[model samples]
Target: MATRPLTGTKVFLILVAFFGVVIGVNVTMMKLAIATLPGTDVDSPYAAGLAYDREISAAQDQASRKWQVNAHIERRADGNAVLQVEARDASGQPLTGLKFAGRLERPTDKRADLAVGLAEAGIGIYRGNAASVAPGQWDLVIEGDAKGERVFLSRNRVILN
Candidate 1:
């Protein structure tokens, strides 16, 4: 039996029809699934639990005085690093009478503990010198009081290079 060749139009029409049915079914199923799904309130129990966990962690940090210390480092052209630290309140304002001590620490090596105290450089700026810190990572610790209360804090892993 002789068979006529299928035209390009016939193939295109078949492909279009097949894709149309698939797309129609997908759209219908998507609509039905969305309509049947339960609404999730963002302030639900699960969300509240997450928020509570975050609050607890923050409270723990505050109790440990970890939130009081803010530390940073700047490198110079002489391969030396200037570790800058400013004691601050929770609102990030510089606090006076805060003592800061830092250390250049490396794993499996001797740690160099630097003794530095906050000095009034200018208006609301406190600076402490770190002579032992070089171009690498180090830790700067600031410990003192806002208004005669104990504040123990430490900052870690500041990159200088």
Candidate 2:
């Protein structure tokens, strides 16, 4: 048999040493790159990006807790938009005799008050006609004062169409 130049054990050791050197060199290069970068909010730019991401997440969480009244837009067959207001107490119980101020805002930047013909048929529903409103996305803001406190409900972004 021909003499083997390198034993299997020797080949395995050489491969392990080569990989170890490669890994060490790669780690050193990464450290050097990090050291050369500017020292701002964090040593690495990725850490700064993570900090911004956390701030955005916190803001979103805060926004979700906002106590805004919930309502829906109803469109009429005559192409006019109708604004419906629902009055509720702090405990979410429907309240009657709630004097509300409803405003319907159209896409043309025109606004009209829908509080004139408001009728309360049930415990907490107030209905009014907004004939000036068109069949598109609209903004409905309703305000009311009951008991001893003033309540403000703004459905800032609503779709009428």
Candidate 3:
């Protein structure tokens, strides 16, 4: 059987089909990536940058208070998560009688975010519990206040293992 090959039409058709498939795949991937974006932390980057000085001043204000805050997580066997928080002063004295609260924020998905609070456990120590938190990375944003004003703020990343 003799075969005739290298026809112009065949070559053109094959090249067109190859490029078409490549374009289709690229479009699909691009759409998926855009659809699954984690999210934006700020609404306006330019505005946020412009306000950077204010943020710095606020942080400096907090630092001036000389309050030290430490926080961590403990994952239990029953799939529950516990958040432990402790606060003190520069002189190592416990900062008691302050309000403390936090949130379990999913790194990528807001749907899985959880609000957790740390009630007073001991002198300067606070604890809170979440019934069931998915095992993964979680950002813990904690705030402490005294006399209805913010005193300390901290953001820590922890893994639920």
Candidate 4:
């Protein structure tokens, strides 16, 4: 059998093919990483740090008030997101008379985030409806305030199917 020699053209073709495959795979992985981010819990690190003192003070105040908050997300039948929140005092009494709000925020894209106004159902229960909440992971933020005071605040990580 006559074997072919390792000519310049063969070497060039081999190098091009190898680099093409490697570059293609690297680009694909980079795109995927940008698409699915881990999580962005805070918008601004500096601002959060500056407000750290106030946050701690507020938390202490809330602790003194002895309020407990429970928050979660529910996927509706219509492929929407429902934010549920419940609040209670340390004495195990329901807490009410507060305005409730929440957000279903994506880690990478703020454009895909959802904001909803939660309505008080009964006995410290609040519900909010959101549209087109695609199945994946989400950062849930629940806040309740009355007369310009932070009555309840919660951040919960949830996964949807």
Clash counts per candidate, in order, are: 0, 0, 0, 0
lDDT of candidate 3 vs native? Answer: 0.88
Give lDDT tens digits, candidate 4, residues 36-137.
775566789999899999988887787788777888788877898878888888988988888999988776676788997999999889888999889888
TM-score of each: 0.44, 0.46, 0.80, 0.68
Query: What tens digits encode model 1's per-residue C-alpha lDDT throughout 1-161?
Result: 99989999999999999999999999999999888655543438977987888666755766754344455666667755565665556676766655445555542233344556556565445566555455555555555544555345454666666
Clash pairs detected, candidate 1: none
lDDT of 3 by residue, 72-137 (tens): 788899988898898989899998899998898887888688988789999999999987888889
What is the C-alpha lDDT profile of model 2 across 16-115, one tens digit per residue?
Answer: 9999999999999999988765444336888778789865775565356453345656777786655566766556777776666667654343423343
Ranking of predictions according to TM-score: 3, 4, 2, 1
| Worst-scoring 10-residue span by lDDT in model 3 | 149-158
Worst 10 residues of 4 by lDDT: 34-43
What TM-score quantifies how close candidate 2 is to the native fold? 0.46
Worst 10 residues of 1 by lDDT: 105-114
lDDT of 2 at 129: 71
